[model samples]
Target: MSVSVMAATAASTTVGTPWINITIFGAFVAITLVVVLRASRNNKTAADYYAAGRSFTGPQNGTAIAGDYLSAASFLGICGAIAINGYDGFLYSIGFLVAWLVALLLVAELMRNTGKFTMADVLSFRLKQGPVRVAAATTTLAVCFFYLLAQMAGAGGLVSLLLGINDKVGQSLVVAVVGAIMVLYVLVGGMKGTTWVQIIKAVLLIAGAFVMTIWVLAIHGFNFSTLLGAAAEAGGAAVLNPGLQYGLTDLSRLDFISLALALVLGTAGLPHVLMRFYTVPTAREARRSVVWAIWLIGLFYLFTLVLGYGAGALIGADRIKAAPGGVNSAAPLLAFELGGPVLLGIISAVAFATILAVVAGLTITAAASFSHDVYASVIKKGKAAPGSEVKVARITVVVIGIFAILGGIGVQGQNVAFLVALAFAVAASANLPTILYSLFWRRFSTRGALWSMYGGLGSAIILIAFSPVVSGTETSMIQGVDFHWFPLSNPGIISIPLGFLLGWLGTITSRTLENPAVAAEMEVRSLTGHGAEGATDH
Candidate 1:
């Protein structure tokens, strides 16, 4: 049958195995919950709770990192994007993969060496503890919330598609269930449990993608060129060219650059990914983790390229878009086309795992930021009662989960990858410049840190709120509203530079430089891992 005919039929009907999908998904969740229970046996101290007691090996931690990094955006969004936009859609994969070099060379080992638990730990090392920690924690929570929204949205779309629930109420219930599960994971497992879940999810996700990739290639005689030709014929010859998505208007081209910039710089600032480094014991292990993660993530992105085009060739974009879950339905639908209801069930399970794991990771990171940084360091004056912090963290987890559920429900139809890009823009704007300055510049002051974080965060948030993403267009979150003034959907192009500029300006204009002796100690510790282990517990 022609691809169009096949897709047209399947578009109106789901794979006809909601029970199978639910059963498979339920099994995975039960298994992971057991793992979390077992892992929580070691949650004795703040370090144990937040950084896994630094017990994980390099490769293990690396695998977990890949799981945390390759979010729903990478799987569902990018696949659907490629199925629709072709070459331009693959740019997200490129930007995401290339982002690791920044993490590896600039942040990974250095971060692991310098700080004990959170990103705020590193930022507050030499600077004024109170102000810097507040700024850092605020930004951390904001980034986590944004990232959480993407994962929750993906969960809603993925599950709703599987069960054939097309109503807003059904999708919202799906998102809430996901949020509750994520809360359970973080509240029970803490970092150690979350890390283990991430590792298992990483293995399953990568393995599933590999199987699908090979199956697709085998059917095409293992020739990529053949796959591409078929895809072009199935969709259009224009699928072979650039600008299918981004070249429509000058504004779109600029938006592409903004998206690329956000993706490239965002990882260095992602709190959950940064926290992954703390799971390992030594700086060397941290570097090794990055190396392992790079290989794994790079390989999986390659699989996505094939998977994307394969979907385009096997099922036309129009049908994929018309289906439940909108664009995010492409991968699951492709699985159904290739291997019927069984593969669809399995793929749906893996997709659910992807969203669940990432959200759990983000939730714990946010919880840690608040309990450790704000409540412990700032509010308690660095003397939180032992065990009290974790209690606070558990509470924060529930609150964050509730907020994520509401936010996810608000953003149902948007592409998961595009929403993730906005999160990246905020991370890049609010955190990266401050982090780079704190590591590299001796004159970088507490004033600079505050300026950079707040300016970047404020600019990014204000611009996003005023941009077309929130209103003014058909695809926007708010319909029948036309208040958008910012032309680009993403604000990275302006906010990122403003962050850097503000940091520089705030530093040079300060009447006082940070104590030179403190700066020297930080420089020595950050670069050489000297005194980093004996560093203050906070």
Candidate 2:
């Protein structure tokens, strides 16, 4: 039988038999709950609640970072993109991998050496605390909320597809349940619980991807060239090169560049990813963890190529499109075709765990931003007790979780990768410039940081709201609406530069004198780690 006919037949047969998948998913959830419960026992102090007591080793922290960073976008969305768009889809993988270089070299050590609980801590170190904290907290919340929504949406779609719950209400219920669980992970387990969940999920995800890659390679006689040839024949010769999905014209090329810039810089600015640095004991460990993460992430992206091409070669693009959730279903369907119901169940369970882990991380970071940065520093004037701060963080977790559930339900039919890309754009545009200037530049005042954060954030939101992503296109989130005036969907190319320029302009225009003592102190501590926070034991 031909690939398309075979995939169609398989789909027809697999519609109602989701018992194995449900059981596997149940098992994963149970294990996660147990891990969280145990981790909660150690999360008594604010330090423990926020940074896992700074106990994770470099390798362990690296694995957890991988889990936190590799959302459904990396596992399901990227695979789907490659399965559908061929070589064009793999571009995202490259961009994501290259992003680690920026994190490793530019941000990781400085973040570890300087920050306490949130990215706001780092940015507000040498600058005035109140305004900078508020700005950082706002940007942090924005990035976390958008990223959380994408993960939650992916969870709902995966649940509906894998468990055969097709109704919109059913999917929304699933999203709510996932959101509730994520809240519990942060509220009870805190950073320690979330980190453990991420570590376990990372292991399972990497193992699942490795198995699938090995299976696909074996089927193709261990010859990558043969596999690519098959994918080319299945998806057409265009599948072997770029421009099938992007980079077709001057405007499209600009859009692609915007996307690449966002992905490359966003990792360094993500609040959740930055929070991971504090989970390690020393700046050296932070550096080592990034190295480990780079290796693991790079390997996983390589395996995604196998999974994507295998899906195209074996299942064909048409069936993948016709599948529920479109390209998002590519990895799961490929799992089913290659390894039967058992493997499908395993992969589906892992994907679900992926969503849960990412959501948990995002929630904690959002909570930390709210409680530590906003509530404690801004509202309470930094007089809030550690225990009270932890309580506030728990409350914030519930609030953020509720919002994420609602947002996820609202964005159910959208593309996971596209949503994630928008989150990246926001992070790159709003957070990256502020972080860079605060860390490196002596004249980076509170005004400059605020302008960078608010300018980049406002520009991104306004552009996206008026861009083709909102309307004026068939793939837009809002159809039958043509109010869009901006041409490009991704706003990083314009917004990122605007952020940096606004920072510069604000600094030169402001009369705020550069504090030489504060600058020297921050420089000395950031480079030598002389006054960094110490790790606490349970």
Candidate 3:
């Protein structure tokens, strides 16, 4: 689209009063801040600050998990992707939802039964502490930082579009503001407060999507075929096929497999999602929570099928690509088309809430890994003064918020879902192998843990840094640069296998043997929730 045509598109979208959107965003911020303040009162201990004292019921924590899991990528990016790419886009929804089954069957209850505050606790239980903790914390920070980037970028685009601020500077400022608010939520309310925000956001998000889905269906006389027919009529029959986005080349097809691997395996290793398991009391609650999360998340993704096609049918793919926020503008634009300004404002607020809740969850998880795993355990040798670790965590939150703001600003126009997939790839590569080994493999050693984490992490980052996603293509983060050497956009296919192999090699090659007794103890504890919450030595 040309500049004149783009301006007309923007003018039409911005016909809904921008101030109304601003008011809605501001009101959400004020209310959530108040909730954070109220939740902060009982955050007097590290357990309270980190795990909410394990007081949340199964259903409550489950709802918060849904809130954290269903990010801006699910609502904005998936819708926009489907609007543009058709069948290929809905694959993201499938990959994300199927990931929960991994969490449920393999990870959730086992992790909750064995670990206390963080995943490091579970890994370091039977292994050497210092090297393992440091490696675990490093990988945790890496995953959380990448995840934060996606949420922050989504915030920037959504707000800039709502306020009609087309300039990059305005969007950067919007991202910075979001980072600051996220920092406050972590510093004050801690996990408890972040959980509340996520619960509220999740409810609003699913509710909002439900209403919009019904509205879109009703507009087409409550017929599913009519909605799909309209989408085909507007775009083409190609919208109904399998090869819309990833079928252009053999390399792109490989990239899709890499992306699928990352998405399906990544959630099992995500630090923020892993930390959520600690918020509940027992293995049973963790199991219940995952079940709840799976059902709720599945229902919401079904809504996306309607919402995405609805946007494609009503807004048209070309216009969405030319809109203020590019592909990320689909859901909000669909709202504007369906109910004008009022619906636009409400939908925008919900999207921002999704961004805020997810970022805050990521922030707290990153900070906890640093303070709990690195500072308190590695640096202080588990003898840190009371309340001092939490103080250090608060400081780390500020530093992380700053970096997330800068990173988000740099990757403004990228798709939030694609960015999240990169995070997933990193998680799958760096963390998943180590986690599975520690929990299930009896001979997994500290050397094995360290090797798997650093090898997987280094390879994933190196590949991403040199991939077309970063510099080669027009839509790359760094446009006008051709430094990329990697052909594939995602590195999961290469890095994830390397992680597993390195772990096995390091364990077998280590001169010192691990104690069989400790491994057996861990197996018993992991399987039967024996000493998770009660054990204080970790």
Candidate 4:
């Protein structure tokens, strides 16, 4: 049968059940509760809440970094891409893992040496407060929104697939439970507690992925060649080489390149991932931790390819294509099919944990930007009492959590990969340039940072909101209206360049207004691990 016919049939059959998902979700909440309660007690200081008092060790921080970086997109989207598109799906994993090189060499150590709570502090280190705050908050919120959407959408899909619940209830529950846990972590456990939660989740996800990989490989007697051949036979060679089927079309190539740029470059710019580096006590430890993270991330991704292809071979792409969720159902359905009900339950639970850990990281990072940068700095002129900043940060966490849940519940029918790519493009466009300029360019000024943030962010949003991928006005007040501002769905190609250009222009315009004293202090602090070195800069 053709792939389309198989997919149509899969959507009609309720092949797998959802009870195991609910049971595992309960356990996730319980464990998270214990961690939150423990972390809350020691979060009396801003440093503790914001940077985990900068006390985490390498391995611990490494796992947490993995936890922060590995979102539902990596788990579900990549798997589906591979099952549906073959090697092109695996390309996402390669690009994602490769971006760490930039982070490790360019960002990891420097971020630790520069900012206190958020990336805004680093970008605004030498600039004026208002512009810095606005830019930082904008970048933080943009990335968080898209990232949260992907996670929430994934949650809805997972719940629907595993427990047989509708998308609305499944997504809302994920947001509610995840939001609550994240608020608790920020409010109660603070950074220390949140780091632990990430570590635990990362371990579970990797272990779970490995178990599934091994089970699948064993079922085929550990022969990778045979596995690929089987998958190809079942799904056709095009599934292994998406280019074979779609490469001839310019539109398809553009889509592939857009997604690749977002996945590769965006990883270094994600606030949640960057925030984790600050939790380490020293810049050196932060660098070392990334090494561990790279290894862990690479291993996990390598295994996912096996899992995806193995699922294609064993569970049969036809079976997955016939499922309601199409390619997205490949992972769980294969889990249930190959490992039976017990393994199926475990896979569902692990998937839920992946979403929870990822969303919690994104929510906390956004909250930190609001509380530490916007509230503590802008609203109070940096005079908000010692613990007031942390208090405000916690409150902001709760507020952001409510919004994330609402947003997740709202964007229900969107494609999971598309949602994730939007976050990446926005991150690369708005945040990356400002951050790079702040770190490397001595001439970078407050105006330059602000313009880059707003310009890149604005351009990307305008383009994406109107892009054919988002389906701009068909669902709006007007009926039978359709428009696509951009032919290609992804905007990283243009948005990322816009950011770099804006930063350059802003720097040239504001050269004379740059603060020499603050710039010198920031330079020293960013180069060295002395938060105390640039105390006067703030």
Query: What are the Cα lDDT values of the candidates?
Result: 0.90, 0.87, 0.91, 0.77
Segments of candidate 1 deviating more than 4 angstroms: 1-13
State candidate 4's TM-score.
0.92
Q: What would you estimate as the lDDT of candidate 4?
A: 0.77
TM-score of predicted structure 3: 0.98
lDDT for residue 353 in candidate 3, whole number 0-100: 86
- Arranged by lDDT, best first: 3, 1, 2, 4
lDDT of 3 by residue, 1-538 (tens): 7785577575644536889888987898889899999998999999999999999988999999999999989999999988888899999999999999998999999999888899899888888888899999999999999998888888988988888877888889988988888888889899999999999999999999999999999999999999999999988989988888887789889999999999999999999999999999889999999999999999999999999999999988877876666788899999988998888988999999899889988988889999999999999999999999999999999999999999999989888899999999999999999999998999888888999999999999999999998998989999887999999999999999999999999999998877889888889888998877666343
Error of 1 at 57 (Å): 0.5
Candidate 2 C-alpha lDDT tens digits along 1-538: 6785776845633433588888888898998989999988977887899999999999999999999988999998899899889888999899999999999989999989988888988888878888888898999999998898789878887777777665678888988988887777777788898999999999999999999999999999999999999999988999999899788989989999999999999999999999999999999999999999999999999999999999999988877766656668888888888878788888998998899889889999999998988888888987887599989988888899888998888877666887898999999999999989987898888788889999999999899889998889877777897999989989999999999999999998989776878888888878899888742100
On residues 1-538, what C-alpha lDDT tens digit does candidate 4 reach at each position?
Answer: 7776666454435544445556766677677769767776777787777788888898889888888777777777777778777887787788889989988888888888887778887887778876688679878988998899878767766666665554456546755665565555556677777788778888988998899898878877799887888889977877766585236698878777877787777877899889988887788888889999999999999988998887777666566655544466677877777776677777777777777778777877888888877777888877889888877777787888788777777665454665787898999888889888888888888778888999989988898877766565532212355666686677888888889999899878774678677777777877887763244335
For model 1, give the 10-residue run with minimal summed lDDT: 7-16
Query: Pick by lDDT: which candidate is best?
Result: 3
Q: Per-candidate TM vs. native?
A: 0.98, 0.96, 0.98, 0.92
The residue ranges of model 4 lying beyond 4 angstroms of the native Cα positions read 1-17, 166-186, 242-246, 316-326, 413-415, 472-481, 531-536
| Backbone clash count for every predicted candidate, in the order shown | 0, 0, 0, 11
Off by over 4 Å in 3: 1-8, 12-15, 536-538
Error of 4 at 204 (Å): 1.1
After TM-score superposition, the amount by which residue 266's alpha carbon in candidate 1 deviates from its true location, in angstroms, is 0.7
lDDT for each residue of candidate 1 in 1-538, tens digit (9 for 90 to 100): 6786676856545654888888887988899999999999989899999999999999999999999998999999999989998998899999999989998999988888789889998988888899998999999999998998888888998988888888899889998898899899889999999889889989989998999999999989999999999999988998889989787899999988899899999999999999999999899999999999999999999999999999999888877887777888889988988888888888888888888889989999999999998999899988889899999999999999999999999999789998898999999999999999988999899899999999999999999999999999989999998999999999999999999999999999988878888878888887898887876433
- Give the Cα-based TM-score of candidate 2 against the true structure: 0.96
